[model samples]
Target: MALTNSQYETIMREYEDRQTASRHLLEERTAEVYARVEGYRGLCESVASLSVSQGRKFLDGDEKALEDLHASLSSLSAQKKYLLRQAGYPDDYLTPVYNCPKCRDTGYVDGSKCHCFKQAIIDLLYEQSGIREQLESENWSTLSYDYYQGDDLQRFQNAVKECKNFIKTFDSDYHNLFFYGTVGTGKSFLSGCIARELIESGHSVIYFSAAGLFETLSRNMFDYKNKDDIVSFHEDLYGCDLLIIDDLGTEYTSNVAVSVFFSLLNQRHLNKKSTIISTNLSLEDLRNRYSDRVFSRITNQYTICKFTGTDIRMLKKRLQNRK
Candidate 1:
């Protein structure tokens, strides 16, 4: 969830690129209008000069000059409006032009967020996530209780109930959850269900594997072209409405990677951002792999949900092989 400094730069650079593209396109259109309005410009200038001269005469007590000035102004206004119509531009378009008329391309309007900024964030998410193919697999409607079966049906049912309750009560202040259990125990299914609901409710969510997070962080740490700084990475992690990190302990446990992981987790805790971390590693293994600091933080900050069940992947593979 933490975006590296290079990633932040990419976001900004994307915004700049979009802005430049829009400006170039608008300039082309404006130039065409200007080319066709040369005659209109000349007429406008002549009318204004005459109006000024007539106004001087009226100031010198000439009543006839005042009448002439008013007539010239009326003629110029009508001609300008007519010319604009002929050019197929709105009458007010010529008054004050804007690339984004709604927000004037400032990314904000009247002290409120602008549609342009919102669009930029969405575009960046789409570009970076690459989750289009997997998104449909996680919808709430696709989840079925029949998928999780065992002597522990009661426990599975309890998890389902808790999940539904969590969705119903979800708000900005809800505590993040860590689903710790064996694989094939429906942790991923429940996490996906939460993702679908949160996304539908208009909250930003990013779901990535723990290994993926480590890989991204490691790459950003060493890559020179990537502009995202450590701070920016931390900011993105905390800024998201919901972050679901799956397979928590699969990453290479280098000293640096472990440190970075704890930093990300700790910051998310402080910010109170909702995170769902699904890990197959037991609590004892977590303590052994990382330090006591991590264990303490996890205990203090997250709601731990223990999952236990048979290996669903092996069962699916066997079934497929049989067929």
Candidate 2:
């Protein structure tokens, strides 16, 4: 999803704060070292002067002067290192400390976003999703087989194993998953488990309920005023490592929604990105709701897992009431 202008400002402010803090820290440490080490302050001045002299000599095409200045600078550098060592400091202790060395805390490298920047965006998106609390309670660590019984239990166990296996060996070549079941049968929970695992492993994930997902797409596609938001919205939708559409068939499916949905599935499929769709709809329902081409792509490219059992939410409520 697209970040508002304020959100973008917040991220940029954070990056600026990091750089400012690093600079302040380096200045403080350098002052402390200079106070403790005699002659170090004078040594710094000499080094700065020599650097300026070297630059002028090169500009003047005086090779001999440049060579002498370089030698002097090298000797000064060695002396500085020796002094720092004697003062019980690392040789590079005065250098700026960056949270992300790749970007030097700027959030970009060579005009492209660094991994840390992408991570910041993912964090913001998760916060915006409003499902953080649900995910916290329903992730992999809390998943249990005690909620199932009989053949339902066996299928649940098998589904859990397959989900874990999917996370363990996940790669670009991995296929998507279709979790179809009645309400409260752990389909969305399993999707959350996989999302949590992959996100913790440094993958980008965007999870949306079917209605919310379609609404965002519809707004971006049709709203002229928020046209700028469309670019970032599309980028995250299509470019994230994994996309999870929970309760897929619950949206108000207009012609625009259906067309966009088809494009989303087709684009992600062609890009080899994985998607997990949890729907409380049967295969026949899916065929009726979506086009034949959409059904064909899903059946051909996705691992279909059919979930069956009593509603776990009701079971939990009954147990709680008994208590």
C-alpha local distance difference test of each model: 0.73, 0.84
lDDT of 2 by residue, 1-323 (tens): 34445557768899999999999999999999999988788889998888898788888898788788878988998898899999899999998999999999999999988999888876765664446677787787788888888988887888888888788778735679999977898999999888777766657678899999988888777778866567767766887778899998889898778988999999998877889999999999999999888899888899888889999999999999999
TM-score of every candidate relative to the true structure: 0.67, 0.69
Off by over 4 Å in 2: 1-13, 21-130
RMSD per candidate (Å) reads 5.6, 6.4
CA shift at 185, candidate 2, in angstroms? 1.0
The all-Cα superposition gives candidate 2 an RMSD in Å to the true structure of 6.4
